[model samples]
Target chain A: MKTTELESYLAERRQLVQEALARNLPPPDTYPPVVHQAMHYSLFAGGKRLRPILVLAAGEAVGSQPEPLLPAACAVEFIHTYSLIHDDLPAMDNDDYRRGRPTCHKVYGEAIALLAGDALLTLAFEVLSRIPATIPPERILRATRELAASAGSQGLIGGQVVDMEAEGQPVTLEKVNYIHNHKTGSLIRACLRLGGILGGAGEEQLALLTRYGEALGLAFQITDDILDITGDFSQTGKQGGVDAARGKATYPACLGVEASRQKAGELCAEAGALARALGPAAEPLELLAGFVLRRQG
Target chain B: MKTTELESYLAERRQLVQEALARNLPPPDTYPPVVHQAMHYSLFAGGKRLRPILVLAAGEAVGSQPEPLLPAACAVEFIHTYSLIHDDLPAMDNDDYRRGRPTCHKVYGEAIALLAGDALLTLAFEVLSRIPATIPPERILRATRELAASAGSQGLIGGQVVDMEAEGQPVTLEKVNYIHNHKTGSLIRACLRLGGILGGAGEEQLALLTRYGEALGLAFQITDDILDITGDFSQTGKQGGVDAARGKATYPACLGVEASRQKAGELCAEAGALARALGPAAEPLELLAGFVLRRQG
Candidate 1:
């Protein structure tokens, strides 16, 4: 596919997921509008919607239309949005901005901001539990289990715990990879695996999609690490070099910029190969892996 | 059920639930022990185990042993523990103590406390999703939906959001009711509803149990509100009159103390009626409602 075509594909899916998310969210006019508003403020804050897009793309790759996958797609985005909100709290990364907008805690006070994150995390499960009856019940159960496990201590939170503990310590490749693979990689991989599960992929297809997802996630994180060092401040939407200031472990920090870039390239190539193995239906996944490689922010 | 027998029954069930929670929790020795330790500290703190015991009693009332409901029982306690942790954050209630010990944030700092809460919330759904294959998948899915809804924006968190927003504002009975019914009542109701659900309750039984649960929760909260003003600090395990000092809206704040006590009595009576309607099978629930009415703390 042409670069412009792939870009259009991403844009279209992004819009679709955003619309679904808006529809799925509790309306802001609901009682206690502050929490809803805070949740809305962070969720609609110009996220790339990459995780939900991957969920849709992976489902499509497995011969399912994106419509049936909307709940799962939105569910992943809710989890991702909640993580970002909590990560930006004063006690966490202490960031003031995300996605070119003030962070949730920046706009809402810390108390509401904390509840906003809690609300979103619970809402993820609520969204998943309400998946339409048209999908096989078993599939919905399986997807729900996968999504919850991915977000729990053994996955996203565990990775976060390790990452937080590792900060200011001497950066080690093994430790950084553990942090990266768990923190960022688990959810990304779960997004793909969920898509495959919902699409009713066979065992071989599920394995391929998981492999593709793991590589894609690693590539995505390495790219993020590189951009934190090299991207324009406006483009990155936060102060550059903040990671270094905080002594945060990063791919470029441990391995140097040159090797980090090479690692991202190799992972992207590996992801592409896995996508290719799935044939023509995986064009979006293949192109998205490339997009991760080429993204500047 | 005799009062002595009921006391022994409550004690035995509470112990069972505690053991189950200990077994279900991820060990503190897991990597990044601080988060797990924080989670463990807050969870094992001396909660009355009322919710889990209710789950067991409700299941027994519906003719199922509590064994099959262990996961659901533990899941609710995890959620309850997480809520308390977040509620005690400096930005929230800012309470230094809970259940006679330092709050999670007080002991573990705000960041880890926040993540510990998040981890527990996520783990609740994880536990529910893994309910043993002995339970019908459909029933598990239905219970999962109920549990998620109870904890999400429209239920527990929604109630909390409004409660927090109402602090120091002029108290109104309607608003306080919304906060109490939603925040505390929702989960309490869920515990009984889940019990019926796991026990293969028919529609009528589920409805009756839900009604009983709603009344029990209201009575429980009213008793708690009254105790905040009238009970001994040593008995309540926290400062008395803290609610009034914080200007937190409570039943006694909106209703005069005499009326609030009367209301609790009425609700307890109403709950007993519902339990009685469920026949001798619901004796534990009936006696428990009476226990709530007679408790001093």
Candidate 2:
């Protein structure tokens, strides 16, 4: 796929995800409107919708239409959003701005913001369990198990705990890998695997996709760390150089910027090779790898 | 069943839940041990295993073996424990103690406490989806959906949101009921309903259990409010009269002490009647309702 085609594909899928998210979300008018409103405010805050797109794209790669996979896609996004919300809490990262606007806790009070994040987390499982007709129950169960493991202590939250503990400390490659793999990589990896699982991919196909997901995830994180230091602040919508300010463990913090970029490029190439090995249906994933490697924000 | 028999049943079931919880929880030796340690700390801090007992009893009422339902029971306890952890956050209720021990945040700091709660919540669905081999996948999925909805914005979190908003304001009886029913009632209701569902309950049996659950939950909360005002602090494991100190809304606050007691008695009676309607197997539930109404703490 060409750059323009990939852009159009992402744009189109982003719209689909956004619409489904809006439709599925509890309306702002619901009882105790503030929580739903807070949830809405944070969810609809402009995002790349990359995780959901990965879910859809991976499903497509395994010869399934993406429509039936929308619920799982939305679920991944919900989990991602909840993690972001909690990460930005004053007790956590204490960021004032997200996507160039006041964070959820800034607009809503801290209590409501916290509840909103929780509700989103609960709702993710609810939505995942309610996938529309034709998907088998065992498949849903399997996906639910994967998602839970990904988001739980051994996955995303586990990564976060280690990351926090490691803050202001000397860095090691092993620790950095553990933090990045869990804190960010697990969920991203789950997205693709879930898509593959929903698509009824065989063991070989699933394994290939897992490899692609891991490479892509590592590349994505390295790019994020690079952007944190060197990218345009306006485009990134974050205060550039915040990672170094906080002394956070990052790819660039451990390896020099050039080495980190080189590492990300290698990962992107590895992911592209795995995607290509999956044949013609995996074109979207191939483009996604390049996209992550080259993304400005 | 006699009161002594009920006591034995409760003790046996509580022991079952505790063993299962300890076995299933991630060990503190796991990578990023703090979150798991924090989760383990709060979960094992000793509370009556009411929700899990309700699940087992409800299953027993419908002629199902309680062994297959242990996962669901443990999931309920996890959700309940997570709620307590988050509720005790400095951002929320700022509770210093729970179950006679310093709260999760107080012991682990705010960040690990928050993540621990989140990890527990995620673990709930993970464990729920992992019900033993004999249970049908559809039944597990159905129960998972119910649990998620009960815990989500329109259910438990929704109630907490309204409860917090109504704090410091003069609250109407209707609002207080909404707060109690949603915040506490929903999950309690879910525990029984999930048990019934797992037992392959008929519509009528499920309906009866729902009525019993709602009435019992209301009575439980009212009794709790009364205990807060009138019970011995050491016995209750709380600083007595703290509800009124915070100007928090409670059944007694809305209905006055006499009326609240009168209301609790009526609810206990109603719940007992519903449990009785479920036939001989529901004796445990009947005693549970009565126990809720007459408990000193």
Candidate 3:
């Protein structure tokens, strides 16, 4: 697909995800409105909705319609948004801003922010279990298990633990890769797998999607690292070079900017090839790989 | 059942749950061991395993064996432990001690404790999804959704939010009841409902178990308030009168000790009657109502 075509495709998918998320979330006026408002603030903070989009695209690739897949998509986004909220807390990354606005904790205070994250995470599983009765219970169970495992201690939280420890330390290439793969890669990969499972992909198709997800996840993080160095504050939604300021381990920090860009390019190409193996319906996935490679924010 | 027989039964069930928890948790030596170790520290602390025992007794009430229900039992305990960890954070209650020892945050520092809580919560859903294939997927899914709802913004977290806001505000009895029902009662209710669902309860039986749970839960919290005012640190495992010191609302604070005791007794009696209605198999649950009412800590 051409650049304009991919842009339109992304815009359409993003809008679909936004509507589903708004519908799935409790309203801002939910009782004890502070926590609900905090949850809404972070969730609707104009994120790219990349993970949910991946869910929809992967489901589409496996012959499932978007409507059937929207709940799973929203579930993944909730998990992603919750992780971001916690990651930006005073006790965690200590960020004051995210996505061009004050972070959740900054607006709602630390305690409410923390509870809001917990609420969103709990809601994610609730959403998954509430997937329509039209889908097989076994499939929904499998999808729920996959999402939980990916978000659990051995996955996302584990990565955050290591990443926190590695800061200001002379981390090796292997350590940086582990951090990147776990911190960001696991959820991204889970998004693809969730889509495939809910979309009724066979074992072979699922395996192909998993491999594609792994490549795409790695490439996406590398691009993020490069963007932190090269992109402007307006485009990136946060101060550039903040990673370097904090002595955070990143591809560009460890391998140099030129080498990091090359690595991301190779991974995206591999991801695109894997998407091609899934045939014509995977065209969006193929384009998404390119989009990740070229995204400024 | 005689008190001695009930004591022995409780001891045996507690041991069974302890063993199950040990088997289900990742070893303390898991990679990024700090978070896992933090999880272990809070989980193995010498508190009564009230929630999981409720699960076992409730399952037994419906004539289900312990083996199949172990995972669900452990899941509830994990969620309970996680909430305690987060609740003790500096930004929350900031308690330095719990269960006669340091809180998770006090031992592991704020960041690790926070992540540890998140990890445990995620693990709960993962464990639920992995409930034995012998149980129907639909039942497991229903249980999963129920647990999440009870723990979400409208449930446990919601209660915490309101409780925090009500501190020093001269809250009414209705508001205090809302806090108790959501923060403590929701999960307690979930435990019984989960047991009933996993044990193949009919709708009518499930309804009875739920009402039994509601009464048991409220009685349990009222007793907790009484204990906090009258029990010693050595017995209750934390400082007494901390709630009043924080200007926190509780049954005793709202209605005075004599009235609080009367309230607890009435609720327990109601709960006991409901348990007895479940037939002879619910004898342990019948006994447990008395256990909650009369416990020293």
lDDT of every model, 2 decimals: 0.90, 0.92, 0.93
Q: Output the lDDT of residue A141, model 1.
A: 80
TM-score of each: 0.98, 0.99, 0.99
Q: DockQ for each of the predicted structures, in order?
A: 0.73, 0.93, 0.94
Residue lDDT tens for model 1, A10-86: 98998889889999998997777889999999998877899999999999999999988998999999999999989
Across residues B3-105, which tens digit of lDDT does each residue of candidate 3 receive?
7888998999999999999998999999989999999999999969999988888888999987899899999999999999999999999999998898998
How high is the lDDT of residue A297 in model 1? 71
Model 2, retained fraction of real contacts?
Answer: 0.91
Clashing pairs in 2: none
Clashes of 3: 0
> Which residue segments of model 3 deviate by more than 4 Å?
none
Give the Cα error of residue B15 in candidate 2, in Å.
1.2
Segments of candidate 2 deviating more than 4 angstroms? none
Candidate with more favorable, higher lDDT: 2 or 3: 3
Better of 1 and 2 by DockQ: 2
**Model 2 interface DockQ:** 0.93
Index of the highest-lDDT prediction: 3
